[model samples]
Target: MASKQASVASFVESAPPGELSNVVADIKALAGNDASLLQSLEPAFRKYNEEQYATVKLPGSSEAVIVSEHNSMGDNRYFDTASQTSFQVEHSSQTASAVQQHPLESSNADLIRSLQKSFSKAAAEHFPSSVVGIYPTSSDSDIAILLVANKYSPQNFWNGRWRSTYTLSPSSGGLKGAIKVDVHYYEDGNVRMSTSKDVDVSNASGADAVVREIAKAENKFQEELNRAFVQLSEGSFKGLRRQLPVTRQRVEWEKIGGYRLGQDIGGGRSK
Candidate 1:
């Protein structure tokens, strides 16, 4: 029989790339059966929070100071203040409470409008422009969340369950020079919420121009995601009794000849 260490080593070898080192460390600790070894891993778990904070910067000022560092379950929120603007960065797992919320049973025009107003207010206050477009990647649930957050009714909410991409452009009577935000859902149950803006500030020279652009984009992305999460949690969407069960299925069509489809099978618990 192979030793426990040997077995763990084999498992680590076959594990997915980027996960091997962590897997090896975990297995080694388990094999040792020592509580202290497990405790030591806590620092590794916290490394992400530190690294995320290191990338944070305040716009328009080099003298920005850290205002607060709030730590929650597997996540951290850092607030930094400068002369012109205050900035915050939330580093959290995809499964963070802000990202995962209960789905809404139904939606209405008034509710949608209210959400849009809130989103616009936050965007206008934090960025150069409001969110002019929302691109959904992989999940319509995100769009549903967006519609519920923005107070805009999704056109085909009742038109059978399917995913669609929405573009709110200036040509379509939306806000001109509006920031573009993308909401992406990952298989690891993580959400990648981000935003971008076009910058053409006049009279700004050298690195200051580049720094200002980056600061604007980062602040916009952070504020949008944070505000959307808050909206989703505020009794607007119905909460699930427990986490939704997720399953993946592969379907092959012999009649269609050489066609294969993959589907994620899950839904909110029936009321």
Candidate 2:
């Protein structure tokens, strides 16, 4: 019986080291793969959470920007995050007068639809992975447009919360022949930055020309918005970080953790 016990212990000691080591390595590899998979899936999960709760608190109801969350769910979920930030840009009466015979003055809905189509096209061209939506105000006094850039990736590791909101209205008096633009930008639900500019498109000839001018202004604002995001992400606005609300801080913390883990694991695998 003692010999039998001794034989069993010897067999166990003689087992291959590579077999046990390989098993341990495989377990670690699986853990790493799980972390990677979760990292890859995080964007979609965040988008789902955002859509489920991030309803834009508009002053009134408008269907133009109320996109179906389910329909927009997928790889580019950042494009679906709803924006609460908004501001207005007013077009002068003189510009309207110049186009009095134009379709915009005749039907406000038509004007909103036209601008939506033009702006949506331009946004797509400028931001390849962006989602654009335009909604006319219930009172017809203004139109709100949202642009969301879907640039989040586990590999590249960005928060992917960049968005811009533009509100367009009809200007009064001296502002005629120009579009007074109030642009608001949000990152992770915080209004971290904004800019206001008067775009002089008085020289624009026709309706199409006017649309082109607006698109140009939108593109310019978008460029500034992108720059502001870069500045904030690079820790240039450390002072502003202290002012962030608790909700925003939580969002930012999660994003930072996710990206840092992704970078560490990615670097480890490469070595």
Candidate 3:
């Protein structure tokens, strides 16, 4: 079993630019809308969160920042600020497999690997201040008991964090039997019910009864994963911006602020 770190590192370092399209296509093929790669990454998060880990990268010049921002809007809305892409390239007149078979052919695989290494080195040099490990994702129902702290009663939407993440390969039985349980954070900072089968984030039979049960029970989880799945496979999210706060009929943020009411502030105004 290749360490997920090694695999991720490889993806970051060796993936090619033009190959992103094909890679995304391959991911879509594998998870079928399992966007953000979470469809295949939750298992790793569960296992690694117990003992967090991170790369030794510096900031400023780093190519990407593995950022972690918390949204306490009674929901966990966390996402990686790191660049979300990976790819492999084939430059010569021959395919990668052909290159491998023909050994001595001048190929693009080497160039691809070189590019990835450069990116990786740049990342480590710049993002030295970033978190070492334990990006978050959640399963709402499992944390039902510890609700008061959030001031967020079971609303129509999910009230948990999202980790826009991915892994080199799907866990367990590929995507089918991947055993990543959803983790519930407590209002009091305790780990709540970590359910075995993410009520909504699982794949059961296509039977109507099963789908219905999964829907009612894992509504939020299912919805979020589905959205990410779509975003990752489809290359973008359909953003619906939140309504801006109402502006007082005459209130202006810029105009009044320039005029200070203090001493000599408006001296050259209207003599």
Candidate 4:
């Protein structure tokens, strides 16, 4: 059992982020439901979850800029405050390795080009004036698409992002994908909404088909978010807002008019 635990620890230290879950499942099977070994690996899992998604550490800061809970997408998206640049960490389903690269220069040039064209068309048709970016994963078989838009003025700001990741199957060439939507809007206070959706692109024949399918799914997801926002505004947020303070008192007219109202009731006052 100790040997098993040691071996599992060693493998985790060297395993790719994508395979970590599989490793745990394998250990659970081997241990025959022995919870001790799995419990021992908790720290490792926590560390991996906390550290793997963090890309940039600010100068003079001892910790990562972002720490997020583990999710199957295994994506890292963060904005650097100092440089004011957004960074993404992409993972390839083929290699299970993570890499940071611009999508245009990827080895899968043809695929990236096709995806970019599709993305542009969709963005222009639906979300004008939005910022969009495409990133290449570790291998040549996957791509991550990011769409961001924000409206800000003197009083309020609204920010939203839709991130989609697509991986092509080696045998069938079909695409498997997921989309994550995040919304943060500030008016008199802060309001946030986040949602994840699974995109069914397995039947999609080509890159254009995949993008269309994703768009359809995204529309539905957006509707869900809209409903959620309305509920939050009417329910949770409404209850939390401040209306009036407990200390209540009448207005003092003597200080405002420089004389007591009782002393000068009529239009004719002391000249």
Q: How high is each candidate's TM-score?
A: 0.22, 0.34, 0.19, 0.44
Which candidate model has the greater TM-score, 1 or 4? 4
Best by lDDT: 4
lDDT of each: 0.33, 0.40, 0.28, 0.52
lDDT for each residue of candidate 2 in 116-144, tens digit (9 for 90 to 100): 56767776776655555655544556555
lDDT agreement of model 3 with the native: 0.28
Model 1 backbone overlap count: 8
Q: Which ten residues in a row have the lowest lDDT in candidate 2?
A: 91-100
RMSD, every candidate, angstroms: 20.7, 23.2, 22.3, 14.4
Q: In terms of TM-score, which candidate is strongest?
A: 4
Ranking by lDDT: 4, 2, 1, 3
Residue 50 of model 3, lDDT score: 17
Error of 3 at 38 (Å): 24
In model 1, the clashing pairs are: 112-151, 112-152, 113-151, 115-149, 115-150, 115-151, 116-150, 116-151
Model 4, position 173: C-alpha lDDT score: 51
RMSD of 2: 23.2
TM-score of 2: 0.34
